[model samples]
Target: MTAVIEVQNLTKRYKDKHALDNVSLSIEGNAIYGLLGRNGAGKTTLMSILTAQNFESAGTVKVFGEHPYENSHVLSRICFVRESQKYPDDATPRHAFKAASLFFKNWDQEFAEQLINDFQLPMKQTIKKLSRGQLSAVGVIIGLASRAEITFFDEPYLGLDAVARQIFYDRLLDDYAEFPRTIILSSHLIDEVSNLIEHVIVIDNGEILMNEDTDAVRDRAVTVVGDKAKVDAWVADREVLHREALGRVVSVTVLGALSDDERAEVTASGLDLAPVSLQQLIVRLTQKAGAETSSDNQEVR
Candidate 1:
């Protein structure tokens, strides 16, 4: 696979704290990657360093096979959209779209205007006068309409309502099908984007934890249910994420999937299997002990 962006031995420090520690990652071309983690997990730091918006304390960053620092050729092909994106005083959404058109060679003005109308954004109002949701819409339109070779969206839906967020997701997928490119979306809503991303990169405590295909990560954890005695025996010596018993029945979540033989063994033991939610699995991986007793809470899509 041709890596569109590569980072080696990357590290970033803020005083005594390490924002990123000895990180090494490669992003392949033309695929949607979900960048996920809890708050303060260094997702923003990593993206900023990759896009040349921030400097890394140590490590090498390359985009399109060349160093991205001060490299106009590489920078021009990338669009970084975050909630904190800024505009000059008196500049409105119109000015933002105009600036984007001049930068992205593949900028789609029609698409931008359509999105503006869809979001009901005011084109004439100064950015300072717009609401938080309106500000988010401006960033969304620029990110989508820019059509950069690689687009990084770092939690750009902060103030958007459920409907507007869904519109962004639907529009993104539609446009992406026709104009494929690298899109890295960082979202706190894991289940919401579960099926949208082809791969997942999880960061926690300023370090990379899991980087694999969306399906592969799903297979890494599983839940087994059956009689408490049988279930306890079956899960012997295995890592258990959660456990609960109702009357004579017990449900337990374990760290690995059963093999073919193990699957047959489960049948023989009268055990039932239920798929683990991706969000739950990741929550278990990233949260502190006893911090979250369950992951059944659903997110607004």
Candidate 2:
């Protein structure tokens, strides 16, 4: 399978700040990729560059095997649904859908209509008058119905409630199953979308931290749950990513996959091994880096 998106030595600078630092990555066709990072970690910047909505200071970007900048052939095959998607003040959901239908090569009118009804989006109401959830719904509708070869959704569920958010996820997964396409989602709600994403790309500060299969990333750490004393003993000398305690019960997430000897030791220790959540793993990794940076700054001071 050919790569749908590729970035080589991509760099974006604002004044003296580097939003992206020599970031190089390739997204294969028909995969759901989760762009994970803390705020100001360059998630939006990278997405904007990939979609040709913003220019990069240095590096190369190829979408659909060609440069995306002003290239109608490549541009038309990609859809970027973001929280700040703009719309004409007077336009309604109906108008936005119409415009998207015209622009996207694989626009599905029937699918769009179905989504509108499912989301209960009022077509007659002007987009400016719609609630925040409604605005997000419009974006989700277009993203799914457009069926673009490579779709980017940057925090597209801003004000949606739990029910509405679930609807969006369900619909996205369903559509993706039938019409497979590369979907890159940047979101802060990690736990919610953990299962939906097969691949995870993590960014920190201004650089790529980790890019691996979701399962592999999860396997990078394991959680041990048992008596607090036993858990601590097992975790000592191991790189602990995170730890939680509830009275006598304790859980510790340790980095590095368990070796055969280690596994036997864990089993012998009367401790149960629990699967670590993707969100927890990412949170710990980024938070650890943040803490280290803070400590270094303090030392400098």
Evaluated with TM-score, which candidate comes out highest? 2
Query: What TM-score does candidate 2 get on C-alpha atoms?
Result: 0.92
Worst 10 residues of 2 by lDDT: 274-283
Query: How far in Å is the alpha carbon of 121 misplaced in model 2?
Result: 0.5
Per-residue lDDT over 186-301 for candidate 2, one digit per residue giving the tens place of the 0 to 100 score = 98789999989999999999888889988888779888999999888888899987888999999888898998898889989999998778888888899888888899999999
Candidate 1's C-alpha lDDT? 0.90
Candidate 1 versus the native: TM-score? 0.91
Tell me the TM-score of each prediction against the true structure. Answer: 0.91, 0.92
Q: Write the per-residue lDDT of candidate 1 for residues 1-301, one digit (tens) a residue.
A: 7999999999999999999989999999999999999888899999999898889999898899998889999999999999998789989989999999998999999999899999999999999899999999999999999999999999988789989999999999999999999999998799988989999999887788789999888888778898988999989999888877899999888888778898888888889988888888888777633243243323322
lDDT of candidates 1 onward, in order: 0.90, 0.91
- The Cα RMSD in angstroms, rounded to one decimal, for candidate 1 relative to the true structure is 5.8
Best by lDDT: 2
* Distance from true location, Cα of 169 in model 1, Å: 0.8
Model 1: lowest-lDDT 10 consecutive positions: 292-301
